[model samples]
Target: MLTGLKTVSKKQKDQFEKEGYLIIKGLFSKQEIAEIDQTFMEMSKKTIKGCFEPIMDQSSEVEDPLKRYPRMMHPHRVNDVAMKYMLHPKVMLILSDLFNENALAAQSMFYFKPPLARGQALHQDNFYLKVEPGTCIAAWTAVDKADLENGTLLVVPKTNNDEIYCPELADSKESFTNQYVKVPKGLKAVPAIMNQGDVLFFNGNLIHGSYRNKTKDRFRKAFICHYAGESTTKISGFYSPLFREDGSKVEPELNPDSGPCGNEFDTVYPH
Candidate 1:
């Protein structure tokens, strides 16, 4: 517990318990945000060319250039400044409280929304994470101001407790159905408007995704840190590309039936 530091109040905790997510305003300082952004910009300039290099390349068949770069993983090895941000005190405190134990880093991603970017499909983080329900949380910190104009995050309230619905592929265009935990009938989707230094702590089970960035000049960048409880287990069949001390890849046993039906189980960590 950080003494004298403003923490998530009990009332806020109640809101998170009821809504499945909480947005903490101004958790990082401008200096910290700048440092993290600088690191991302530098890493983005590097040309990756190996079994794991594609993790940073965004060039995609999609028209949107933002979608060109896939999520970047295992950045701690590439950027020390980003590693500092990943283990920030404020972020760790909140994770400790929510998980009721010391949390360990499971993954990190840099979602760069260049102009005219296509938004990600709405889905539960666990759909990709493959962790046990309620045992993981994603801490998303914005390196730039996130708002509706630039395609900020939109989340469905109170959906974390619902049964882990079968995840649809990113290409599915259907609206919410029985198989999907649709946004509440009457409540409108809320865009999380955050400053550069703000952080949104969301349950892995929460139904959320971002909109496409429509602005031609402004870019939306977010650094997400995924943390899990100490006892968390890796899903079988999914092999995380994270490198070990000897630079060898560790392939976890995968569940024969895991993954999106016939799609391959793509690991998002250790990139």
Candidate 2:
């Protein structure tokens, strides 16, 4: 147990199973959130090779904020604090109950959605993770308040069991990523509005994405991690080296890069 937070209840689990997503309020404490914010804040001041590339100087009036604060990919591989949260006990425990088995940490990403930054296009996570036998799940922790004006995440309900669809090219002007999945007929995208310390967990197959950060001052930062069930035997090559809750590495077989989206549209983890 994490102090004031209660363990996940059956009702919560049922909501996740039925709606394909669940939001747990204050999963991370204020102190923990501060730690994450500080870690990334310091990281933004320098470049970390493949993990993070930021144009430290953004004083120009015309410079894009994203260029100076692009999303940090696979940061857990380089930062201990990121790895700590990726395998946070409370999150791992909830994943265990959700998957009915131990959960393996597969990937960690930190999005610094600075003002006026373009959002990711709608897409299914399994399109990239490709976990065999079972799909991946995301534990997205908001490091700052996220809402429509700040480009919060948007998700479509009842799409967890749907097959991964080949995405169409998204409008380059609005989306940072090219891939876009159309919401199924009759279903609409809803905002997963969250406050600092809140964590939203969603299925790998769920259709989700965000829009551009329209606000001038707000930054919708988030610490996102993906996990697979212990039974998973293979995953995308990009995320080959998974980690267990105990901080031990687990190398699952590499799932082929060419997946449901086909070779022409083979998914790549955005750098």
Candidate 3:
């Protein structure tokens, strides 16, 4: 017996339904963003066995910045701050509104897309997570200002309702991820220009990705989390041991097979 969360308005839900995504300003505070900035900055210096392992040696010869600084996968497993934010009340509220059911936290990632780093190519989350019956949703929060020149996120509108598409090979020079979802003929790739603390929530099937961090000085840092609706019965093991807002875990059934994207090659996390 849960009433819909009032934190999210119907108008906002309508926008998400129409666009497959919506950007909420100041969903996190300046102080919160700053703390996250500090935490990840410190984490970048050291290597965590399985969570975060960034190369500290400043080697200019490294053509791909990601080789030197890789993204943090599931820091919430070891960091309290990240865990708190992943199950933040506001985020869960917005997600509940979007899913029309309770929201279950699935996966979390932190991207430190440094200058000249390769960006992830366009792809659908369902192609990976394989959430059954319904799809996953992503809540992406910018830790720094994100814009076109600094590898801001790019998304195609109205693709939320589309089926998972098998991705094509992407240009290695521009994209770090191997798979790229082709945008439908009529849709256009739009930029998500966001200030620090802005959260962009989108559907699992929304065609979205980031571009190369072209700037020499800026790092497009972001915290991205994925969630499954209460109705979901199965998902890829890559996102198992989901969590509830109260800091408890919920393990869903495994999806067992590779999604439409196939298992021809190894796949990394896509934010």
RMSD of each: 5.6, 3.1, 3.4
Runs of candidate 3 exceeding 4 Å displacement: 1-6, 257-271
lDDT of 2 by residue, 44-140 (tens): 8899987887776757324667778878888999999999999998899889888989999998989999988888888999998899987999999
User: Each prediction's Cα lDDT score?
Assistant: 0.64, 0.87, 0.85
lDDT of 1 by residue, 1-271 (tens): 4465556788888888788889999888898888888877777766543211433344462443633554465475466665566666688778777777666565666777777766665667676557642445889998899999888988888876755567544542221111233464665567888999889998888887766777888889999877665445564233243222223344443433333211222332221
TM-score of each: 0.77, 0.93, 0.92
lDDT of 1 at 133: 28
Candidate achieving the largest TM-score: 2
Off by over 4 Å in 1: 1-5, 49-62, 67-69, 169-188, 234-271
- Residue 129 miss distance in model 3 (angstroms): 0.7
Sorted by TM-score (best first), the order is: 2, 3, 1
- Give the least accurate 10-residue stretch of model 1, judged by summed lDDT: 172-181
The number of residue pairs in model 3 that clash at the backbone is 0
Any runs in candidate 2 off by more than 4 Å, and if so which?
1-5, 57-63, 258-271
Clashes of each: 9, 0, 0
Candidate 3 residue lDDT tens string, 1-271: 2354336678988989999999999888899999988988887778986678656667742756776677788788889888988998878988988999999998888999998887888889888888987898999999999999999999999999998887899877778777888889999899999999999999999999988999988999999999999889998886778898888888878887633222213444332
